[model samples]
Every structure is written in structure tokens, then in C-alpha cells.
Target: MPLPNILRYLHREQRFLAVFVVGAALVAGFVKLAGEMQEGDTQALDIAILKALRLPEDPSQLIGPSWLHSAATDLTALGGVTVLTLVSILAVAFLLLLGRFRQALFTAIATGGGAMLSTFLKGLFARPRPEVVPHLVEVTSMSFPSGHSLNSAIIYLTIAVMISRSFEDRKSRIFTITVAALLVLAIGCTRVILGVHFPSDVLGGWTLGAAWALGVGLLAATLQRKHKIEEPDGSIADQSSGPAPDQIGS
Candidate 1:
């Protein structure tokens, strides 16, 4: 093979190695956190963070301005089940309209599986909602790993990875993934601010959700490479310029 081709192969191998390492680290971190929670070792830190987000004079009020409170509430709703479901449906429909049936199916399966995994983890831990501070939002479910944080991270990150596959440039792909990550962070923070979950819960959700998204993306890329699944059509962008679509993973 040519020198350029060998260099390209090495770069691809490095990128895959980096992604696999990150996913593995995230899984390990989540497992450690979960173990600490079970041992009641994280309760002190969780209480401290929750209290610090609230006023000493009034635990009911958050530390920030009233407008920030309202904004958090609105932003947090984006992670709710109804909104996520609608977004998933729209994404699937859009892909189907473009004749990307396999991609649509993959997206559907990823999102659905993530949701089920979130529910299963919550039930398995059976952790209760935070009571260190009064909850600003009404919640009635177990909360070791925040549902909102986990679900939003999975859905948004998965979609972002899929969408980024259409972009042939490194900058565009990085920007797309960065935006999705920020949105996921914002949603997770809102859960803590609203006093509905411990800080650890949000952390666990983020780590596991990110790991799940990365895992599924790697799987899809492997399947595509083996000719078992179709590559994205790159219909979202003009591919007349920039690098080849296969240079980036799905």
C-alpha cells in the first residue's frame, strides 16, 4: 500500500482505539459510582451539593435568579419522555423519507434499548429521590440514576453521532457532537438544581448514557464495514467538498 494509505489506516485505528477506551472508562466509572452509592459512601457529597445549590435561608429556592429557575424548568422538560419520544419519532420518519430504512431501524432500536436499560437500572438499585432539599419539580420515581439525564444523553448523543456521519469534515462532526453533549450536561444539571436527584445520580446517568451511545455507534460502524448495514446517505449536507464520509464513524 502507498504511504498515504498506510497513514490513513493508522489514523482510523487510533480513532477507534480512543473511542473504545473512553467507552470502557465511562462504564468503569459508572460501576464504581453505583457501588459507592450502594455502600452509602456518596450520600455526604450528594447532600452537600444539593444544599449548596439551594439558599441557606430557604431550601425551597435555588441559589440563582428566579428567571434562571424558570429557564431550568423549561430546559429540563426537553429531557422528558414525551418530548424525547416525539423527537425520536421525527428522526426515524426523516430517515425513512430519505430511504435510509436500516439507519432508521438502528436509531429506533438504540433509543428504545437505552430507555429500557435506564428503567432496569433504576429498578435494580431502587434508590429514592433526594430529600436533602425540597424538590422544585414533582417526581415520583426511583432516582439513583436520573431518568431525565440518562434518557436525554442517550437520545441526543445517539442522534448527534448519526447526524455527524453525514458530515465529511472534522470540524462539523466535532461541533455537532459538542452541542449534543452540552445539551445533555444542561439537562443533567437541571435535575440536580431542581432538587429531584443527587449530584451522583446525574453523574451516573451521564457516564452510562455516554457509554451506551458510544457502544451502539461502534456497533453500527462495524456492521457497516462488514457490509451488514448501509452507510448513511450523507443527504443532510453537500458532500461535494471535504473528506470522504467513511473517514468518520456513525
Candidate 2:
């Protein structure tokens, strides 16, 4: 093989290895956190964090300005089912319009599958909602793993990964992913501040959600390498004289 080709192959393999290792580590961390929660080892820490977020005089009120509370409520809704579903639908429609059928299909699957997984985990644990503080928002589900945190992380991160592919520069890709991460962080924090979830619940959701997104990314990369999926916009295939796979149906 040519030296340049071999070097490219090595670089690709190294990237795949790094993603796999990070995904595996995230899964392991989630497992450990889950086990600790089951053993009641995280209760004290979770309770303390939840309580600290509330005012000493009134557990019902969050320790911030009135506007901050209102802002948190609105931000938290971004992670709700209604908003996420609408966002997912719009994203898939956009991808389809771009003739990226496989990308749209996978995005739907990733977000939908993540939601189902979140529900299943919540049911499996049957953890009660925090009673140490009054909840600012209404909730009526099990709470070992926060649904908002998990769903938002999965949806936003998956979308970010897909969108980043359209950018040619590393800085643009990093910025996109960073924005998604910040959104996820903000949503998770709001859940705690509103007294809807234990801190450990958000932590569990983040680990698992990130692992799921990484797993999907690995699959997408593998399929792209095998010529089974559309390559990114700026890939070598897009530079060729022939039409790209994603542009076939356009």
C-alpha cells in the first residue's frame, strides 16, 4: 500500500479505537452509578445536593432570583417530550429534504430508541421522586434516571454529530458539539434546581445517554467507511466528479 494510504488507515483506526474506549468507559461508569444507587449509597449525596439547591427558609423555592426560576422552567421544557419530538421530526425532515435518507432514518432511530430506553430504565429502577424538597414542576414517573436529561443528551448530541459533518473545519465541528453539550448540561441542572430529580439521577442519565450517542456514532462511522452510508459533505467522495450517494435522489 502507498505510505499516504497506510497513514490514513492508521489515523482512522486510531479514531475508532478512541471512540470505542470512551464509549466503553461511559457504559462502565453508568453501571457503577446504577449499582451504587441500588445499594442506597448515593442517597445522602443526592439529598444534600437537592437540598442545597433550595432556599433554607423554603424548600419549595430555588435559591435564585424570581426570573432565574422562570428561566429554568422554560429551559427545562426544551428537554420535554413535546419539544424533543418536534425537534426530532423537524431534523429528520430536513435531512430527508437534503436526500440523506440513511442519516434521517438513523437520527429517528437514535432519538426514539433513546426515549424508549429511558422509559425502560426508569421503570426498572422504580425510584421515587425526591421528597426532600418541593418540586417546582409536575412529574409523574419513576426517577432513578431523569428522562429529560437522558432524552435531551441523546437527541441534542445525535443531532450535533450529524450537523457537524456538514462543516469542513475542526473548529466548527467542535463548536457545534460544545453547544449541544452546554444545552444538555443546562437541562440537567434545571431538573435538579426545580427539585424534580436527584443529582445522581441526572448523572446516571448523562453517562448512559452519552454512551448511547457514542455507540450510534461508531456505527455510522463504520457504515460510512464500508460505503454503506452517505459520506459527509466535505469528504473525498463529495469532491469526485460523480454525484454523491446522498444526492442520488435529489
Candidate 3:
């Protein structure tokens, strides 16, 4: 088949089509956001949002009760290295046990690639963390793209998409994807609320992270179409009909 026809067929799938549109928007938005941040155009907005969580009397302290602080801290940890790593490992292990080695590898690559990309972008911008309010958590890195926010989005969304693809029902796929999106958003919001990241930093992280996941997903879909990567029932298909011969469809 022609490349265009293949793409058209892929686009006809509602999920992949929605992801492509969202992914393109995110990439473009990330570029524009990075440019504006570089020029220091977002200082006022950042400060305003950062300070919104603080009391009027003491700018250094957060306005919420003590429990809220603890809650934010706990929620933000969901995006931390330890938590994300554990989730990824468990997911990869489950897939491996299911004999879905290709899917497992792709999941690892998408997450690992997102982390590397986030680090590179942070260094490229070399933006500092917010000093307008006292940070609730320790951080030691350039802060244009929030590592937590980026990695959380990358890890959760990538895993969600992978798992959702295994299901044969539309509602199940949508539910899983929606939950992942909410978790990603909550994690990003906690970073900003805790005064560790500016709103723009979180925004940039989300944009790039989501785009990266979707890009990887589309690649996997393409491979699946070409029979290089197997579908959800590939294992059963293999058992019943021997291994599928690798071939590109016309």
C-alpha cells in the first residue's frame, strides 16, 4: 500500500487520530512556551500563580492547612523517581510475562527517552526554579522542564496506552486513558502548588511529555500494522496458527 493510504487507515482509527492531533498541538505549544520562557516573558504570570497558594501576610508560607501541605507532598511523590521507576518496572514485567516482549521494550524506550529529552531541554534552557515562594521540596537542577511532571506524563500515559491497546472494548480503553490523563494532570499541578516549579515549567513538561508518548505510540502502531509488532491477541493467534508470517499489507 502507499504510505498515504497506510496513514489514512491508521487515522481512521479514532484513538490514534485523536492522539496525533493532540501530540502535534503539544509539540508546537512546547516550542512557543520555551521561546517565551527564554525571553523571560512569563515572570509575572509565574509569580502570580506561585504566590496564590501563600498567605497574604507571609509570602514564604503556603496558605493551606498543615494537612494540605502533607497531601501535596505525598501527591507530588507519585511523580518522583522511585514511584515512576517502580511502576514502569512492574508494567514491563507484566508484559514480559505475557510474552509481549516488543511492547515491553517500547514502553521502556518511551519513558527512558522522555527522561533524557527532559534533561536535555532543561540544560538547553538553564532556567532556574521559582524563588518567588519557598520550595516545599528539595530540587537541584535546571528547571525549565520539570522532571517530575514530564516523567510522570511520559510513564503514565505510555503505560496507559499500552494496556488500553490490550483490551478489545472501546469503553475500557477510554477509561484507562482518561485515568492516566487525570493522574498526569494532578502530578503536574502538585509541583506548581508546592512552589518547586513555575506554571510554565509544568506546562512545558506536560506538552513535551505527552507529545513524546504519543509519538512512540504511533510508531508502535505502524510496526503492528506491518506485523513487526504483534497485536493484543498475537500470542493466542500464534498458538492457534503457528507464528504469523511477517508481511506488509497492501
**Lowest summed lDDT over 10 consecutive residues: which window, candidate 2?**
234-243
Candidate 2: Cα lDDT at 90:
94
lDDT of 3 by residue, 1-250 (tens): 6686577556557666787899999999999998998888988999999988998788767887878888888999999989999999998898888788877887888777877787788889999889988888888997889888898989999898887766768899899989999999999999988999999999998998889878877887766665565576653334445444432331
RMSD of each: 4.7, 4.3, 4.1
For residues 10-122, write the lDDT of model 2, one tens digit per residue: 88888889999999999999999999999999999999998888789988787868897899999999999999999899988988887878777878888899899999999
Candidate 3 weakest lDDT stretch, 10 residues: 241-250
What is candidate 3's CA lDDT for residue 81? 85
Which residue pairs of candidate 2 clash?
none
Off by over 4 Å in 1: 232-250
User: Each candidate's lDDT (Cα)?
Assistant: 0.86, 0.86, 0.83
Give the candidate order by descending lDDT. 1, 2, 3
Model 2 segments beyond 4 Å from truth? 234-250
Comparing 1 with 2 on TM-score, the higher-scoring candidate is 2
lDDT of 2: 0.86
